[model samples]
Target chain A: MTSLTQQLVDALGIMVLGMGLVFLFLGILILGVELVARCLSRANEASTPSMSEQPMPALDSRLVAAISSAVHQYRASA
Target chain B: MDGLMAFWAETGIAHFTPGQMLMMAVGGLLLYLAIVRGFEPLLLLPIGFGAVLANIPHAGFTEEGGMLYYAYHVGIETGVFPLLIFMGVGALTDFGALIANPKTLLLGAAAQFGIFATLIGAIALNLVPGFEFSMKDAAAIAIIGGADGPTAIFLASKLAPELLGAIAVAAYSYMALVPIIQPPIMRLLTTQAEREIKMEQLREVSKKEKVIFPLMVLGLTILFLPAATPLVGMFCLGNLMRESGVVDRLSKTAQNELINIVTIFLGLAVGSKLSAAQFLRQETLGILLLGAVAFGIGTATGVLMAKLMCKLSGGKVNPLIGAAGVSAVPMAARVVNKVGLEANQHNYLLMHAMGPNVAGVLGSAVAAGILLAVLG
Candidate 1:
């Protein structure tokens, strides 16, 4: 092939190879991050109980009502 | 009387040529654009002043023994200065936007079409009378499409030293004009709805991921395209210094003192190449035309690619961010945000556009490496 022909061919090859590699490198990066995020979320899940699994302790209704009444009365008086 | 006459004959006015006067005027124009117009003053100021120095009659500024000669030989010819600039750029870059949306790398890669397309355009210009560009010259000229000034200078110095002055000037001029050049193409390609499309907020990238990112990119480049190591390696070194958090001093030095020092030498050396014989040719006009085309094509393609992705992603991606793929750094991103805001008052695309903006840098570097591998 002539030198020009070779250069044209080389340019084509570069376009393909370069673009392919860029996508590949970035693809691998995306996959790696997804995996890391997945693992992190799993670790957190294992360490912490679900909201349904760990409920809050109940309070005395009469004491709660008295406190709410006192706060409301104090604001009204002020 | 004879001694006085001899001294007068030796003065700059005695030996000045029309070409030199024209070039000095051109230099003054560049200075005006830099200082008054605020067009890339950090670079164009030194370059314009150097042009004046180079063109002064009987001055040896560009000759073998001159300061610019040494600066050119030490930095630009050796491809050290541009790499140093890249290192500084890396130090300043935050890849978190890209990391949060790796798919944007494709937009970066897609923008490189401008370089290859302009290569063909450079070669095609040979058909015009008084225009002749070899493959190497075309390669050098085509890199202006990369939209990265230092990369253009580096590749031009290596491939076509004769065209270095025109190529560097064209590259930086277009870079400075990005705000003006990109918006129209971006608006023309995308509809108001596409521009107004809001993207989801990017997830935060972890510090560990940030530290690993540059090393991984460097390793991949070394493995696949060793020719790219010079540019990519220095870039990764600067990035690693920044991301590692252990080398704050080194990163700051690279980003500030080292880069500023090299920019002065690099600008002067590039300006030295702007002497009359090298720049006053049909090829210079061709280079400028081809460079504008390249930038336009890169911007258009990036927007089109984003439109395609927007369709595929069910409109999750805004097409305005595509223009950022031209790699004018935060400037292109800012344009995207501004244009997007014009369409929708509440839509802010700055952070999203940054993903493709930084990706364009890496994309261009890789494209330059590929060209070197093929033609160097």
Candidate 2:
């Protein structure tokens, strides 16, 4: 029952509202993705050194001394 | 003699109308396109077969108690099939490319202008004597521009069930023709230098980021546009299952078996709508024309946005990747890469084009949401 003029006007309204919302939504999504990536990278950076540093204590002092003595003997023999 | 004549009257050939015959031929052409030309064979083959089945006089295939009637009502009419298909697509898709380069989302957003542009075109077609599309009809027709078949079918099923056959045909046909249709527009929109621009390598996306990406997208959709929740929600669920890595069994089924099963039913259900009474109309022709215009416009706008981004980014971005924003999935992305190769053989834009290509899927879903929210 709506006239052609009315339909055209409504179509234009949808076009504007639709495009504006789509852009705004996607733009915010971009920001969200960027923030997530940055935070994950930062978290990885913060955790990595500690992870690497943890293995040091797991090695017994006796094992370290034996390895060091072996290295020293090998150098002397060579 | 009376019994013999009665039997003849009951025969299919005796009851055939020219319209039914024409529709059958159309179905046959669709079959040829699918089997011979390999145009979206998975969907077109079933759809073509369903169309043939529907048109047989007195077969009652599309009647109230018919199998196709139940198929249409249970799957497409309720809008479950497309959402299920979206979930499968989500499971199959890899978001690492989009996550690596989020700026291409703008290209995805820009390409949806084609939907809106075609909306007005559909409305304008009313000036023609035989064309009389309502606002809902126009909205449904315009979504063919999105270039995502599920979205097109979903929107058509929702907003304009009568136009479902024409819109689905136009959408899938244009999608199948993406390689041929998009390259010229992509080339026409960008200079050779712009086409040959080599993008920087995308950084590796960590597992944790991939896990959170779908959740974030779903959260935003829920907050801002709940209308899109059905489509976006399923997509996110599938992506979450895939990326969570703990649900490999479920993800594989969603990607393969579940999707394959739904595709068969969805194709047949959609084909049922192609009865002669529904499809042979002037409006159908308008839908086909507008669908192509929508696709062309979407491609052009996507490329133009890429060109703008290229200008802003100091030529580090290739504009050809913009055309992939039409969201024909890997087909559109592959077309971008092929055209990019023509300009520079060593330059592979597949990974880069994927960022916008996936974004195009999201873009069309959001656009469909907007249309549904506004009109439905």
Candidate 3:
């Protein structure tokens, strides 16, 4: 083949190889990231309390009323 | 009287040629563009001054043993300056947007079609009379479509040093003109409705993810394309330093002082190549014309890719953000955001566009590596 024609063929080869490699590399990266995220989320879920678990105990009503009355009395005085 | 005439003969007035004068005017125009027009002043100012210095008749600025000659030989010809600049670019870059949505990497890859297409166009230009670009020259010129200055310079230095000046000028000029050049192509490729599409906010990427990214990319490059190590290695180093949070000082220096110092020398070295005999050629015109064509094609293809994605994704993607695939960094992304806003005032596409913007950087680097591997 002529040198120019040979070079053109080489360039085409490069285009295919280069573009394919880039996509493959990035695809691997995407999959890796997704796996990492999934694992992290799973770990987080394991560590944190699930919604089905019992909620924290309610605050004492008398203490809450006392605090509220104190705040109300203070505001009225001001 | 004979002694006075001999001394006068030593002056610039006696040694000046029309070509040199014309080069000086070109230098002044570059200075004006940088200072008055605010076109990439960080690079254009030094390049403009260097061009002026290079054109001074009988000054020996671009000759052997001259300052610019040494700068060119030591930094540019050896291909160190562009690599250093790439390091700085990496330090300055934030891959958060790209990491949050890795699919944007496809946009970056798609945009590189411009580079390859332009390669064919440049080679085909040889069919025209008064134009003769070798395969290597065509490769160097075609890289201007990549819209990444350091990549263009690095590839030119390696493959076609003689064409470095025109190629660098074209790359940086097109990068600075991204706002103007990309918008029309973006508008033309995508319908108004497609442009108005709002993308979901990118997920917050973890610090661990950011830290691992550079290493992963480095490993991939080493395995697949060792020829790209110099450019990709340094770039990843800067990014790792930035994301590592341990070498804040090094990252700061790489992005600021180191890049600044390299930019001055690199610009001057590039400008030194703009000597009269080199710059005033039919080949230079061909380089400039092909550069625009490459950039336009890249921009259009990027938008078209986004349009395709928009279709496949059921309109979750805004085709406007695809223009950022040209790899001009935040400039191209900002243009995407602006154009998107024109279509739908409330749509903010800056962050979305950034995904493809940074992806474009990696995409172009890979393309450069491919060219070097195949042709070098």
Candidate 4:
């Protein structure tokens, strides 16, 4: 009878402590991961311009003409 | 005539006991499930074969100085195989999704609630006669909820070696049945609108972040929970090797060849424990029932957590992906995607679900460490 009582007490202790610690550990992990990501992205931004932020490079008139003409020829043949 | 009788008595057929025959039949059933039903054949096939070998009368396969005896002591008793397997799992896994959505870490933690919940349930079962489960035994049994076969086996070996066979079998079987057992619980816990909630696309994680992730995880684990370091450290080592890109050879071997060999031996060692006396008990039945319940509770908690996050995050999160927190790896994530697709065809939650799915692996290891610390 004493053994069962002790086990029940221990079970409750584990349930509380286990869930609390798991959440605590993972919670800290979430922060750590987010912090690391922020630092890395910051370093990346300092070194190179982002693709989205960069203006599109203007195409040369000659290249555009060639491309348009090729498309036109393909369309006409089809 | 006396010499002939002596030879006949030594034969397996002449010496076979009914218990041995029944255990062999169980082993055959595992093989059938592995080959014909295609259920976790990588581990199940070897395990089933080991069971058959162990049950052969007069073979002494599980006796001292035997192959199984050595495998069990060398691999399971020292808790080496599962840690090696964890390293392989780390090398194979991609944490980019988890890193992209850090909030999903809570979902992973929440899913582990099942392990603790089942711990209570196991102890409660003692109210019935003929069941004599100690706190350690209950802790070992409850880990079947973690849904990670290696982690369950490791804990069972430590806390209750006698229960290792039943625990490992239940863990793997429930994991294989995740697709079947999880859907109904997921649907019951969530609404159609919640299932179809499309998450924003995850950002592209940088190479530097990828390389640092495993190290950071190891650092945190070592600092906070040193007991978990064996499992988490090996996993981090494998991930670091892969992410560093400097040791592709080591990483490849760890993920492919090394893991494959360890898995074979681990399966056989676990199966060797399935001898008739240890396995054919009412306790085995109790362990199986608790295992299924643990999985169900884990699935429910995961879904409920996701629902809470969805509500908290203004419905940007799909509650279905929470079920992946049970850590059945790609299978749980795939089921989440399927359920999401059912709610809305255009909803592709596979990548999103991967975040919680992998987080589940880490969550279970942490849960195992807590069990070991408290109960060991």
Candidate 5:
């Protein structure tokens, strides 16, 4: 059986590996968000007529969250 | 008359002994600093009270059967309070800013370079007289660089509770000093224009993103560092409770009432460790001196990394926000914002800085976990 020290060493190695993974995940997440933003802006450019008139109100989050939770509860009831 | 004189000499004038009197007085000084000057009042209040309690000559308060000793045993020795504090922090934090600007994580990661560097410095200091430090002790000591109280307390309590007195004081003192220590380093590292650089407005962070973010973070922590799970998991739970839209009452209590209660007990218990025999030593002085060095190096490294990021991104990042990468949370971020306004009134860096500010908390907790894994 592995001694506690060996187990601890193994854990240390895993944690280091995990930190690297966190960095990678964060990097990928940033890139993905930026790319989606580009696609979204492009879609807006193609669909809209005026170059700049009045921007649409950004997605209202609190409303959506409330609606979603209410629907979820309703579904549960049903 | 001789008997009365002897009793008075033993019990009245000579009762305290010099060391006991000095430590007891130090406790009162701490209280004055906390209440009047407002130096980390949440922590300093309890710590001061505990210090007074501990140093009352032959109090037996922090002895084996003492109340403070029992409190320490139940909460700190078991490493429960810091974990709970982490949970409250997680519940209170709004992670949408981090998710909106994930690039800020780099600044957060860059700041932790201080803790590791200070670890080496601490080991070197072990060569000094009155300082007998092991690798575990050095790691615990260096976590003051993280500018994180719970992480410092968590690591010190586990790796070197003997050093808990110095470490806790160092951690909170530096945390309170963030407004003082960070600005000069920030100004030194960044040009006036770089300090004034205004970040583009952050995109609206969707609530869905906010809710899922904690879960994703918790998943990562569990997979990567189980030792950090207590700190990280509790933090995630707190954030989840806040974001879930389902448990506002529990979330509110956790953030306000629970955290306040824990802070009082935690501060007192930590203070109780600061007896004259433990705290008023040459080694404690060394810990205090090295703590400043660690915080300075950490801040400088973070600023340097932000400078690098600015160069890479063609001056998109305000290097001043790099100073916020230490885990003093909104305090560090507010200083960045205040400095930004001084440089240019139109510049608003608070929201942007908060992304890295909160991320620093996670990064430090992770770094603390790494230390625990190695040392514990």
Candidate 6:
């Protein structure tokens, strides 16, 4: 027969093992949520008509110039 | 003339034992390591000084209730110094990265594999001649792998006080040697491609989340593992002191002056335990050997766990950060960043690794408590 000390040791081992497995599971679970969120957002964008069909909203004049400059640089790089 | 000679003979001390003389030399070596190598001088200097004092021919400082004995009773025996140290650690630690990237908690959990594996190995070592250890002793010895000094002391104090000197010395020594002990294992475990993997930027964690995190951990620890209450309680108190921003003076004291002062006492107390009788035993050598092996395995396990996550996440995670999981704090995290940079200049893993770095401290404390509750 196993001593009480042995039994307690066995029980402690199992509990610690359980805790480790839980953390591993939780990491994967969080990653899954991020992946799902990214996928759903992409799908929503595909279903909608392009926003360019509507007139662009008015922006601060400085902001508009800055946006155009950034676009121009990006296009040159591409 | 005869009376003067008699007085000199009576007042003088005896010649040193071979053991005491050798320990003095060892003490000098530790002093050199601290001063020259810049390895944990805050603790090692005091510990080395204490060893010198204790091993003197007739100091009797380590006698029943001397100052060194009292220091042991007040600081280490009752487990106050370690808790106070934890408080300082909490203040020094920024939980922002950990709270932002909670998934890194797994790396911390995975790192503890070394502790339990060492326990098994230690128990098995008892089968050899000249070494005999109980479960409590094995557990205490195994905690050296956790790489956190206070957690090792807290557990050893409760589980096996006699071995506290050897265990605490081993723990602190290994902690200082982390940059040396860890890198080779890390290199061996990862391929050039894996080492060169560049991870994307981590998301920004809000200040509010960082402020609330210690409170949450403190609450969970109190409810679930009351045995861990002292460690969790003191650490949370330090974190609260730091974040509350109302008591900057006390926070600074805990983080700087108080912890530094207590580190001297803690180190000296630990060093006093290195008498030839206690520390020079065959079991001490076995503990050191097993501790190193356990550390290697823990590092490997943490890396493997990160590789698995990399696979699951389609290689977005950097496996190098996994080495920071063993609770040497920012040092381990900094090493991760340094190694990552060596592989690729642009790859910085510092902030990313801190998530698991701080988490590993908590993981080791919890593991220590579990061992105490079960093994003690």
TM-scores of all candidate predictions against the true structure? 0.89, 0.93, 0.91, 0.93, 0.84, 0.84
DockQ of each: 0.22, 0.66, 0.31, 0.64, 0.08, 0.08
Tens digits of per-residue lDDT, candidate 3, B1-376, equal 9999999999999999999999988889889989999999888888888889999988899999999999999999889999999999999999999888888888888888889888888877777888777778888998898899999999999999999998998898888888888887887788888888889988888788888889988988898889888889999999999999999999999999999999999999999988889999999989999999999988988888888888899899998878899899989999998998898899999999999999899888988888898889
Per-residue lDDT of model 1, residues A20-58, tens digit only: 765665566567656665766677679676545756799
Q: Which is the winner by DockQ between candidate 2 and candidate 3?
A: 2
Instruction: Give the Cα lDDT of each candidate.
Output: 0.88, 0.94, 0.88, 0.92, 0.82, 0.79
User: Quality of candidate 1's docking, in CAPRI categories?
Assistant: incorrect
Model 3 chain B weakest 10-residue run by lDDT: B123-132
lDDT tens string, model 6, B217-289? 7766665667777887899889988887889999999999999988989888888887767777777788788
C-alpha RMSD between model 2 and the true structure: 7.3
Better of 1 and 6 by TM-score: 1
Docking class of 6: incorrect
Per-prediction interface RMSD in Å: 2.6, 0.5, 1.8, 0.7, 6.0, 6.0
Per-residue alpha-carbon lDDT of candidate 2 for residues B55-132, written as tens digits (9 for 90 to 100): 999999999999999999999999999999999999998999999999999999999999999999999999889888
* Top lDDT hit: 2
lDDT of 4 by residue, B1-376 (tens): 9999999999999988898999999999999999999998998999999999999988888999999999999999999999899999999999999999989989899999899999999999998899999888999999998899889988998999999999999999888899899999999999887877888999998788899889998999889998888888998999999999999999999999999999999989888998999999999999999999999999999999999999898899999999999998989999999999999999999999999999999999999988887778
lDDT by residue for model 6 (A1-78), tens: 244356346545744763564354335434543444455557667966764477768889999899999999999999
lDDT of 6: 0.79
Task: Give per-residue CA lDDT, model 2, range A1-78, as digits (tens).
Answer: 368888899899999999999999999999999999888888898888766644434778899999999999999999
Chain B TM-score per candidate, please.
Answer: 0.99, 0.99, 0.99, 0.99, 0.96, 0.96
Model 3, position B182: C-alpha lDDT score: 86
Q: What is the Cα-based TM-score of model 3?
A: 0.91
Per-residue lDDT of model 1, residues B1-376, tens digit only: 9999999999998999999999999899999999999999999999999899999988888898999999999999999999999999999999999988888887887787888888877766666778778888988888898899988998998899999999999999999999899989998998888888999999987787788789878877878788888888999999999999999999999999999999999999888888999989888999999999999999988899899999999999998888898788988899999999999999999999999999899888888887888789
Alpha-carbon RMSD, each predicted model: 7.6, 7.3, 6.3, 5.3, 8.8, 9.0
Q: What tier of docking accuracy does candidate 2 attain?
A: medium
| Model 2 per-residue lDDT at A78 | 100
> How much of the real interface does each model capture, measured as fnat?
0.28, 0.93, 0.33, 0.87, 0.07, 0.10
| Model 5 interface CAPRI class | incorrect
